[model samples]
Target: MKKINPHTGILVALAVIACWFASLFFLLNWHFNWSNPLVYLMVFVQMHLYTGLFITAHDAMHGTISPNKKANNFIGYLVVFLYAGFFYNRLYAKHHQHHHHVHTEKDPDFAPHGFWKWYFSFMLNYVTIIQLVIMAIAYNLLKIWVDEKNLLLFWVLPSLLSTFQLFYFGTYLPHKGEHDNEYHSTTLQKNHFIAFITCYFFGYHLEHHQKPGMPWWQLYKVKE
Candidate 1:
């Protein structure tokens, strides 16, 4: 129901797509030669780009990318399918709402605590590259055993799941103050830098919390 800036969203979407295609070119070319360390390096770079693309897609879901709900939903789902492999819109919305409301608390969406300790608990409260690799392997193995189809289940599905998990956990956990309230500490500020790099500058959580209606490009200027 709320309006957003269409031009900003289109530009971001275009930028993400262009970067993704460029990265894909290098990744595909390098995929042919596993013996070369450069291939592995390119793979790592591509994976990060893949994650960043998903983050941009998240911007769409938040309606920060456009005023058109239909366009936002379509772009959001496409990113989910391409990056995360699932279509859990209801789940994403519900969890993200809680993430904005609770953020960094015990019940926060990104909390790595509780029974799911391995996935949730961490000092940095961010997913490690090693964890991602392990999850990728596990997801592929399960998909092969369950679906008997190797393609989507192996590569695409796991990537989607990981992206969703990252969105849920990364944004929800590590937030220290109540929503709409002033940020509580310097630690949060420092963490934002790390998040910025990992999430393509979506890590400016305090600014975002203050101005949920603003586009990502304009959120950096929000005062705490």
Candidate 2:
């Protein structure tokens, strides 16, 4: 069995959720100041938080968030919904398919096309009309109280950018090229800080595929 701090997943989940909401609240209330460097910084900050939200949900899908199935799934459902109106059950099934079929045609995440084509195909797997409708509804409702600019820049834009951040570091790079390894996955050079900053250690893609039970925070320990 893989050694792990069972408490870490839930704790990290709570931290990511709390930070996402807090940053969103602050940004929604904030006056826009392009002249201010903090305005720019906060975009990246919120983008990272958005990625963190998905990472939390991903961990939950693996049942790493808690030993209790209900708690684990609850956290998964919560974070994915918070991320972008994603359905936990839908993602759960698709993700398992991803693992089982991997890079094969049956894999929901597999796209043999170039980056842009692959990205759109990847987005299609999870992005639904329902999600778009939910986002539209939420935007209209929230804009009544919040500035539209702040909502777009801080909320919508960051979330969109985070998709690129996630797809590039986590999916595109790791699985783009052929690999001789059993998992058919590529990992980054062993730089723990780079791994974490890139995608919460998801850059260690081969290690993750090998030990799907391991949580994101613990990937570095196993990188060796």
Candidate 3:
């Protein structure tokens, strides 16, 4: 409910951007023999790391990682364009705000309950390698058909949009109390852990949900 402070958000956003770009530069420049399996493995690892960084950026966008509105918007835009490749202005805000307010439920943004339900649901809900590949192919094919000047939209735009949706469903939805049947259990904790491992522990969901105003590093300071 409190207004986000811009100064803290800018600082955090800059740091996150620096880390993301640095990792990307390293991965792109690394000498990799496409013919070698190890090189392919390295590529896969780098991709996963990039995904994690992207997730961190998502937290920043929600202002859950920092209190800077400008910084949150800027970082959100950067993440969407540079990493995920979409440009959602109002929709991102609406979806994210609803997530914070509702946690999880029949909310279009959250996931429904069940163990296997959560697993398969989350996997399908999030932006995975398969989704990225399919998007890329679809974009190229669409460009060929549409003859559009901006070919990036076909893949990049959808990737960004889908990534944002995934962030909402995969992270926010599962942790919603309603979706969890009003019982916070180990499964929910594991969900947070999975998000942490996937996202470099960018402020666990429990911490963020409890204290949305805290910066990313300090989120863990909050106790349930």
**Which candidate ranks first by lDDT, i.e. highest?**
2
**Could you tell me the lDDT of residue 205 within candidate 1?**
62
Error of 3 at 168 (Å): 11
What are the lDDT figures for the candidates, one per model? 0.53, 0.91, 0.50
| Per-model TM values vs. the true structure | 0.61, 0.97, 0.55
Please give the distance, in angstroms, between residue 148's alpha carbon in candidate 1 and its true position after superposition: 16
lDDT of 2 by residue, 1-224 (tens): 46667677788889989999999999999987789999999999999999999999899889999998998999999989989998999999999898998899998888999999999999999999999999899889998999989999999999999999999999999998789987779999999988888899999999999999888888787798
**Every model: Cα RMSD to truth:** 7.7, 1.2, 7.8
Clash list (residue pairs), candidate 3: 4-67, 5-67, 5-68, 85-156, 104-176
Off by over 4 Å in 1: 1-5, 29-32, 103-169, 176-195
Query: What is the Cα-based lDDT of residue 90 in candidate 3?
Result: 41
Q: Per-residue CA lDDT of candidate 3, range 1-224, in tens?
A: 35545565566656766765675455444554447676545444444444544655656655654455665666776765566444546446655654545534533344556544555554453345754675576667756645343233222343344343445544544354543432231123434455444444432555555444565544444432
Candidates ranked, most accurate by lDDT first: 2, 1, 3
For model 1, where is the 10-residue window of minimal lDDT? Answer: 183-192
Look at candidate 1 and give me any clashing residue pairs: 4-67, 84-160, 85-160, 104-175, 110-169, 112-120, 112-121
lDDT of 1 by residue, 135-180 (tens): 5775667555444332343344435454544554345343533444
Better of 1 and 2 by lDDT: 2
